[model samples]
Structures are given as C-alpha cells and as structure tokens.
Target: MLGQERSRSFTATAILFLLPAVAFYVVYMLLPIPMSFYYSLFKWDGISPTKVYSGLSNWDEMLHDTIFWGALRNNIVLVVLSILIQLPIGLILGVLLTSRIRFVKLFKTVYFIPMLLSSVAIGLLWKYIYDPTFGLLNSFLRLIGLQHLTTGWLGDPATALFSVIGTICWQYIPFYMILFMAAIVGIPDELYEAAKIDGASDLGCFRHVTLPLLRGTISMASILSLVGSLKYFDLIYVMTEGGPNHSTELMATYMYKKAFHSFEMGYGSAVAVAMFAISLIAAVAVMGVTQYDARAL
Candidate 1:
C-alpha cells in the first residue's frame, strides 16, 4: 500500500510538471488549428463580426487559382532542390569534417555561421550579392569579361526563383550538415574498425556502414526540408515579396497577402488549412517511404 501511494505521488508530480507546457500548447497551437478550420468555412473580412457561411467556396476558389498553384509549384521546386542538392552537400561536408581532416573545428564553425543568421538578414545579404547594378556578382563577371552574362538576377523572371532557391540552400545547408555530423559522430567506431579488418576501403565502409546507420537522420532531415520548404516565407517575402510576377511566391506568403493585405481572412484561413493538410500529407508520405525502404534493406 505504501509503494502504491509513492507511485501515485510520483505520477501526480510528473503531471503537475507537464501541465503548464500542455496548457500553453492547447491555448496557442491546438485551439488555433480548429479555429482556423472553422474560419475556413466562412466569408469574413476579419473586421466584421458577421461571418457569412460560404461552405467550400474558398477551397473551390483555391483549387482553381493559377497563382496559388504556381506558388505551390515553387514550394515543390524548393523541396526537390533541397533534397537533391542540399542534403548531398551537407552529407559530404559532414563526412569530410568527421574524417581525419585538418582544422575540423574551424571548418564546422565557418560552415555553421550561415545557419546562425536570420532568414531575413540572409535574404537581404544575398539580394545585394545578386544585384545587377554594381553588385558583387555582376562586378565579378565584368572583371572576368563575362559581361554578357551579367543581368538583373532577382528582377528577371527566368532567374529569380533559382536565385532565391540558392539563397535558401546556402542558409539551410549548414543545418543539415550539423544534424548529419551529430549523427555521424554518435556512430560506433567499432563498426568502422570491423569494416577495415574485412579489407573494406574508405568508400566501401561509408557506402555500406555509415550510410545505413545515418538512414534515420536522413529521413528526419528530409522531412524537415519538405515541411520547411512548403511553409517558406520570411526570406522570400523580405527579398522579393513573391515579386517579379509571382515567380518566387510561396503558400505562406500568399496566405499572408490574403489575410492581411487583401483582408480576405476566410480565404486566407482556407489556404492555411490547405497548407496544414499538405504538410501533414507530405510528412507522412516521406516517413512511410523511408520506413518501407528501411524494412527492405
């Protein structure tokens, strides 16, 4: 009876400790999701208390909106490029840093510096770097006598999306690098030694042992990349405001424009809800595929 009482007391203390965080999450996160879903079914300018029931009209409109589709496509482009380019680069860098490389600490710090900067700041910095008139990029091109290649990067529709994506990769690659590095460091050295004893080359050990061990971290990084790409807003907003004819507009930026700029709160809520659905779907799909792959392996 005494032992049972002590167990109950411990359980009560644990619940008491968790209550504050759970309350905050319910107040700020959980409640807002349902509220957004409810708002999505109404037509309101946000100022009027009268919410006209529109049913699925907002969703219907979003489905037909070409601009919204374009923004979504741009988001997908970011996700694809991040998975293909960013992850590989980060993985390579992580491997190199973990190997018998010189100045490992210095290299890690330098690589991680970009991730420390605010997205807005990084956007502004890259904006200047890509500037056509008297910008570093154009100036360098001119110096190298490639003046023909120098054009307004951000202002040009052909290059705006790619330029912004490059900035996004630069800002985020370090994050994946650090993530991968941590996972790589945690791997048992005994595995590597065993591979070496079996006459496995460096590449062989990495291909067979390291890559398999890092599968979980890779899946995590992939999910994070996908979700973040879908909701990407700050840097793009600060850099272009989805400008140059909406070439770089993301779903989040479009939602903001509808909600605050255009005063279409209901429409914005619908977009937000749609984004939430898409994020959940993408995360689940990626996780499912990774799990299947792991099982197959």
Candidate 2:
C-alpha cells in the first residue's frame, strides 16, 4: 500500500508538470479545429452579428467547385514533384557533401543559402529573374542568340505552374539536404571501412550499406515534403497570386480567396476544414507507405 501511494504521488506530479502544455494545446490547437468545423456549417460574413445556418450547403458547393479541384490537382502535382525530384537531389547532395571533397564547408554553405532566405524574399527575387522583357532569364537568352526561347515565364499559363514549382524546389531542397546530411553524419565510418575491405565499390557501399541505414531519415523527409507541399502557400502566393488565369492556384490560395477576398466566411471555413482533412489524409497515407517501405527494407 505504501508503494502504491508513492506511485500515485509520482503520477500526480507528472500530470502537474504537463498541465501547462496540455492547457495551451487545448486552447490553441484542439479548440480551433472543432470551432472551424462549427463555422463551416454557417453562412456568415465574419462581421455580421448573425450567422445563418447553412447545414451542408457550403460543403455541397465545394464539391462542385471546379477551381477548387484544379487547385487540389496542382497541390498533388507539387507533392509528387517534391517526392521524385527534391528528395533524390537532396540525397545526392548530402552524399556529395559527406564525401572527402575539397572546399566541403564552402559547398555546404552555398547550398544552404537558399534555405536561409525568407520565402517572400526568394519569391520576389525569382519574379525578377523570370521577367519576360528585361528579366535576367530573357536577357541571358537574348545575349546568347537564343532570343526565340525567351518568353513570359510567369505570364504564360502553360509555364506559370511549373515556374512556381521550380522556385518551390529551389527553396526547399536544401532543407531535405540538411536532414540527410545530419543522418549521414550519424552513420559509423567503421561500416564503410568494412565494406571497403570486402572489395565493395563506392556505389556498392552506398546501395548495400548507406541506403539501408538512412531509411528512417528518408521516411521523415518524405513526410515533411508531402505535408509541406500540400499546404504550400506563401511563395506561390507571393510569386503568382495563383496568377495569369488560376494557373498557379493552390488549395491554400483558394481558401484565402474564399474567406478574405470574397467575404464568404462560411464557405472559407468549409474550405479550411477540407484543407485540414486533406492534409491529415495525405499525412496518414504517406506514413503508411513509408512504414511499408521500412518493413520491406
């Protein structure tokens, strides 16, 4: 009975220690979610003293909104590109940096510079670079007798989405690279030495040893990239404003338009709820797929 009392006392102390954090989460994160769901069922202009109960009408409208679907498709495209392009390139850069290359520190710093800059700053800088007439890209093309190749990159609907995607990749690849570099650093040199003694080439060592060890980090980076892509807003918003004909529109931008610009608070809340739902679903899906990959490895 004395030991049981002590155990109960320890549990009480632990709960006391956790109380503040739990309270903060309840107030900030947990409360807002259900509130958002509640708001989604009403038609309110956000400033009106009254809210009209709209039931499932907002959600039903969203189902038929073609623009919303387009934005969703764009978000999916971003997720795919992030997985296929950014992750592989990041892994390659991490491997190269960890190798015995000269000027390793310099290379690392240069590679990481993009990740350090503010997203808004990077977006503005690239906007100038993609300028059609006087932009750096067009100017360079004209200088090299490739004037015909120079076009309005951000203005053209065909190129606007991809142009924004490229910028996103440039800004985020370094983040994954850093994650990979840290993981690579944790690996033991003794393993590589053993592989070498066994007459394994560098490629063989990487394929058989390094890849397996980095599986956990790879899974983490993939999930981060997936979720980040889904909620991607700032850079694309600043760069394109979903521009040139909704070509670069993303789900987040669409939500902003509905809530703030259009003053459809209820509809916007519905969009927010959907956005949250999609993000959660995608995250769970990625976790499951990566878990499977981990098991297979």
Candidate 3:
C-alpha cells in the first residue's frame, strides 16, 4: 500500500512536469493547424469584420493555379538538389576535418562562417555579389574576358532561380557539414583500426565501414533537408522577392505574398495548409523508408 501511494505521487510529479510542454505544443502547433484549415474554408481579407464561407473554393483555386504548381516544382527541385549537393560535400568536408590536416581549426571556422550569419544578411550580401553593374561576379567575369557570361544574375529569369538556389546551398552546406562531423566523431575508431589490420585501404575502409554506419545520419539529414526545402522562404524573399517573372517563387514566398501582400488571407491559409500537408506526407514517407531500411540492415 505504501509503494502504491509512492508510485501515484511519482506519476503526479511527472504529469506536472509535462503539462507545460504539452500545453505549449497544443497552443502553438496543434491549434494553428486546425485554425489555418478553418481560415482556408473562408474568404476573409484578414482585416475584415466578416468571413464569408467559401467552402473549399480556395483549395479548388489553388489546384488550378499555375503559379502554385510552379512554386511546388521549385520546392521539389530544391529538395533534390539540396540532398544531392549538400550531403556529399558535407560528408567530404567532415572526413577532411576529421583527418590529420594542417590548419584544421582555421578551415572549420572559415567553412562555418556562413552558418553564423543571419539568413537576411546572407541574402543581402549575395544580392550585392550577384549585382549586374560593378558587382564582384560580373567584374571578375569581365576581368577574365568572359564578358559574354556576365548578365544580371537575379534580374534575369533564366538565372534567377538557379542563382537563388546556389545561395541557399552555400548558406546551408555548413549546417550539414557540422552534422556530418558530429556523426563522424561518434564513429568507433576501432572499426577503422580493424579494417587497416585486414589490409584495407583508406578508401575501402570508408566505403565498407564508414558509409554503412552513417546510413542513419544520412537518412536523418535527408529528411531535414527535405522539410527545410519545402518551407524555405526568408533568404529568397530578401534577395529576389520571387521576382524576374516569378521564376524564383517558392510556396512560402507565394503564401506570404497572398496573405500579407495581396491581402488574400483565405487563399494564403489554403496555401499554408497545403504546404503543411505536403511536408507531413514527405516526412512520414522518408521516415518509413528509413525505418524499413534499418530493419533490412
């Protein structure tokens, strides 16, 4: 009877400790989802005194919206490119940093400098670099007698999306690099020592030992990159505002324009909800696949 009473007391204390976090999650995360969905079913300007029930009109309009589809396509491209570019480069950098290289500390600091800056700051800095007239990129191109290659990077529709993507990759590569470095640090050195005893080359050790062990980390990084790419906005917004014929438009940027800029709150809410749904689905799919792979292994 005394033990039962103590168990009850302990459970009560645990509940008390968890209540705040549960409440926060409900208020900030859970509540907003349903609220956004509710708002999406209406035609409100967000400043109006009345909300007209549109009943899925916004979703219908979104389905037929060309720009919405384009933005989604851009997001998909970003996800693919982010995974393809960031992971390999980050992995290489991680390996290099972990090796017995000179100036290792200095190189790590220099590589991580971009991650230290605010997204808006990076955006503005890159915008200046990509400037057409007297900008670093164009000036260098002219100096190299590649004058034909010098064009407005952000202002040209053809290059705007790619230029913005390159900047996004540059800013985020360091984050993945750090992640990979930490994962690499956690790897058991004994495994490498064993491989060496078996006459394994450095490349062979990496291919057989490192790659297989880092699968989980790679999977997690892929999911992070996927979700982040889907919801990306700030840097692109600061740099181009989805300009140059809407070539650089992302779902987040488009949603912001509709809600705040165009004052189409309902449509914006629909877009936001759609983004949430897509992200949730993609995350779940990746997680499931990773779990299946783990089980197989």
Better by lDDT, candidate 3 or 1: 3
How many clashes in each structure? 0, 0, 0
In order, the Cα lDDT scores of the candidates are 0.92, 0.92, 0.94
lDDT score for candidate 2 against the true structure: 0.92
TM-score of each: 0.90, 0.90, 0.92
Error of 2 at 66 (Å): 0.2
Model 3 TM: 0.92
Q: Highest TM-score, which number?
A: 3
Q: Which stretches of candidate 1 lie over 4 Å from their true place?
A: 1-18, 188-205
Candidate 2 per-residue lDDT over residues 1-297, each given as its tens digit: 569889999999999999999999999999989998999999999998999998999999999999999999999999998889899999999999999999999999999999889989999999999999779989999999998898999999999998889889999999889899999999999999999999999999999888989989988988998889999999988999998889899999999988899889899889899999999998998889988988887
Using TM-score as the yardstick, the better of models 1 and 3 is: 3
* Candidate 2 TM-score, C-alpha based: 0.90
